[model samples]
Target chain A: MKKTKYRSQSGNAFLVAVSAVILGLIGGAVLMAAIGSNPFMGFYYLFRGGLMNIERIGNTLATATTLMLVGLSVAFAFKTGLFNIGASGQMLIGGLCATLVAHKVFLPRPLFLVVLVASALIGGALWGVIPGFLKARFNVHEVVATIMMNWIAYWSIYYFVPAYLKGPSLETESASIAISQSLRAPWLTKLFNGSYINYGFFIAIVCVIIIRFVLDKTTLGFGLKAVGSNRWCAEYAGIKVNRNVVISMMIAGGLAGLAGLTFYTGYSRNMQIGVMPAQGFDGIAVALLGASNPLGVLFSSLFFGILQSGKGFMNAMTSVPPEIADSIIAVIIYFTATSVLFQRFWDRIARRRGSRRADQREEE
Target chain B: MWSTLSSIFPYAIAYTIPLLITALGGLYSERSGVTNLGLEGLMLVGYFACAITIRLLQDTMAHSVWLLTLGLVASVVAGALFSLLHAFASINLQADQVISGTAINMLAGALTVYLARLISGSGNVRIRMGIIRKNIPFLSKIPIIGPLFFTQTYWTTWVVLAIWALSWLLLYKTSFGLRLRACGEHPSAVASAGVNVHRMRYFGVVMSGALAGLGGGVILITYSGEFHGTVAGLGFLSIAALIFGQWKPLGILGATFFFGSATTIANVSQVIPSLSVVPPVIFKIFPYVATLAALVLFSKKSAAPKASGQPF
Candidate 1:
């Protein structure tokens, strides 16, 4: 019975996520048809755009780098029952720190990358911890606080990128980081055949494994999860609920900051002002689609990465506009985030099937 | 000095109107126990709808006043319709309210831009509206108070003020308001009292949508003359005001005015001799900085609805 329960839980999670993807695809297809395009052709190109060639595949993976880290940041916070909506701010601060280190701090290759990564992590942690601290100490809602934080970070970049880190001619973004100082390792870039893939993917993989282990195996993870599942109960059991909340958000912010490090230093090569990273908001969808699991987040971010990278190609190949592709992605996220609705749907079907089988067995 | 203060005062009040409308919209949903973070999205929908409708009517309408009034109504209707998605998801499916609201915001943003591109073949919705500044005939003659309060004000400002009065009366002086507030604080108690908690919650959320949507029209017609597929985070800023106001009508007015002045200074600070030295970005950051400070300072004293964000 215990084995069945375990099997069923995993099975249910798998089924729910798969069904959501299917529903999202169907919704995308309908939107495609609405625009007088062939739905199958649209999807065919959508997938092919992401995977048609070695270079395309590499670009897709590269795009996934920041998303993967951001996804994990959100998922980690979800486990502690805290919504770290400030991931965008964390990413900005993290990326800003890394950008500063890349431009100012000169060192050997290995040492330089280590300093860059560490600074990004610390910068992100600082951003994340403030909201957690506010929540713990002052009862401020993270959602409101984080939203405020996002604008501050956005405007800060608007000022800082132009004032201090201005490129030779462009006023919109910071000066580009040197190739050697960046997270993009030469060997990995060569392996991807000139695609934008970087060492950030490896960090994401490591983070997933570490986060999974911490969540499932470590006492710290257990304590955070316990606090999340029921703070009052965890408090009664002698856990420091507020401390766990702060730590959870700090780590979550650090992970998001790492995403920024990769995004600004590796993927896009520089941070731009007047724009907040969409990846921060997209991370919310990634966590929801992944059911707030690290492994699930990895896969979901990849899927989103493909959709985003392939969108330009899809627009080029089809009459359907790029905004249609975006709307389709948004629709999918809408359906996926409402997984509770799907769970009830599946449960009803299961109940009916089980009752029918029991009736036949009673007759026998 | 008084002239500078008066010059800034009207702009502050103009900005305050939209924030006041949106914050009051937020108040309704929160009072009914559903955390409607989707106010941003709903406002976007309303703004987009009203802009499109007004842009279309501008070609035919003989008078601008009729066009603006009809556009405001269109926004409210569009906002109410859009909010049903949140109402259904949170009330029926019992999805996490914040997540649902965030999804609505994302969807609103993506959908509005996509549709606008398809319809207008442009990146933004532009409306041709000159500032319809009014000087109240009787009041404009009343010395210092006259020009600051009555001159150069749009009808939207008066409309929003009326809404605040209406909202206050409905919330503090009516049976429906009592039941609505009760549902947010304690749904079970309301249910036991024979009031339908879900229905009350729905009304609260829909009213929020209507008000937020109207706020969208006000912002577009009064503050700016175009729709850009974004509400500039006014929704969240209004949420800040809602918190600082301690969920009361008059309190919201003060909070909205406080934030409005911050934004006004940010926009016009370059002309002010003392503020010119600071980067305009610093001015832009002031409202958000104030929001964070307000949340931190007021979160403790603010008595949020007991069961807010919980599904009935």
Candidate 2:
């Protein structure tokens, strides 16, 4: 009976998630209709644009890989009850550091890759560590601190890219890294028909698996979770709450930094100024939608990636702008964030109905 | 050096107005425990709303400067309305405040861009200035402070300062102020004392939206002199200013001016022979670097409200 009850609870959570998605879709459809576009046709093109063609699918995967890393970064922090909004800044700094190492440092191809990834990880971890330290020691709010750090990261990169690393013409971007070509995997190059999908997807998948294992199997993960759920209890149990918070942020930052690798090594290959990409913020949505689980983040990140790629198809096939996808995402986040309330309401209704049925049986 | 400083003085003050206004807005929300990270989106809506109002009334209300005033009012109302969505989700629904804020930001951004396209019949909207600038006769003649603080100061500068003073007074020296701070520091304690925590938070968020809207209107009228998709990021910078200021209205004003000066210096660096030796981008990093340094320094000593990041 206990096992069955546990199964039913899990089932209920799944049903709530599904219902939230449906509600999001309905919201998107209503928005489309308001915008004078055919909702059905818009969704059709959205799917076609993101999934129908191999090239589009490759682009979707490429985007999803980066987003997955970012999502994992955020989820890792959330699991430890740390809100790491600085992911955008961390990713930017990581990308900049990796690009610098890849271009300026001379080493074997494999060594260069390892060093570049490490630099990204270190850079991001340092960025995240600031807020973690502040929160743990001084009681500073991580939300405010991380948000400030993001801006600092953005402007710092903006200056660094153009001032120090710009190409010969002194444009608003750095030159392509020297090992950029070497970083591409032959199979992925051919599979995408010369697109930028390389082995980063596999790396992201591995990272997700490792993260899942760490969160589920490791004593450290338990400590982190305990600290997240109740700092007082964790402290009483001899767990160093401060250390866990900092470690979680470091891991989160490292993951975000790895996301930068996908962009630098696989896609953009150069640092562009005045552009703060949305992957970091989108990762927040992905993490929340995935319920802050590593495996869940992978699928949600891919879903969002497909949504983004499909947005292009939506624009191509109809008068609907790609922004409809953003609207859909916003709706989904809104509903998902409120799912707990919905669950409680549903539970109350179910209980009332069961009680009424019992009363009817008693009367009989 | 004098010429370079003189040329950039007005623009510096003008640039500072938006950040100052918006930071003050953030102060209200944060003082009551709701982090107003959606300031960027609120500003976007405010910018577009003000620009559209000004444009629609251009011919009909062209003769009256009051039309611009009306535009400002409309912008603030629109911003407050936009922020109400955030307030509902974060405050009422008990959603993850940051996620709800992020969603609001995205929605605001998307809505503003879409509305701009719809109204302008193009991807950008430009507003024609109709006597938006005027010399402040007596104040304009006051020596060094004259040009820097008075002579070339836009009307919005005065408005920003007045609002800052007003907000400071309201936040620090009033019964409502105590209640609001109580709401932020310990909502349950405030509730036990018969103060409605939810109402204070709602008021805080709405006021935040209004001020942010005013900031947007100031930007449209004074600095950018137009509105475009590019104006979105300034709101984030304003949020940084709020943090750098440590959530105090007066401190935020100083932080805003500092960032504003950094921005102005970055823009005019090319004209200064000596400073021209340094890369313009380096100057651009000043505000950000300052923010980082300030955060690192303040992080060691600064204490946030006791109940911050907690859902009431």
Per-residue C-alpha lDDT of model 1 across residues B235-282, encoded as one tens digit per residue: 888887887787788888988898888878878887888666777787
Fill in the DockQ of model 2: 0.41
Query: What are the chain A TM-scores for all the models, listed individually?
Result: 0.95, 0.91
What's the i-RMS for candidate 2 in angstroms? 8.4
lDDT of model number 1: 0.84
Question: Model 1, range A1-364, lDDT digits (tens) per residue?
Answer: 0000001124477777788778877877887887688999988888888989988898899888888899999889888878877899999999999999999999998888889999999999998988888888887877777777887888788888899999997899998888887888888888888888888888888999999999999999999889877788999999998999899989999999999998999898888887778789888878877878998999999998898888778878987666655666566666665667778889999999999999999999
**Candidate maximizing DockQ:** 1
Off by over 4 Å in 2: A1-13, A105-109, A167-170, A176-183, A352-364, B59-64, B120-122, B230-232, B277-303
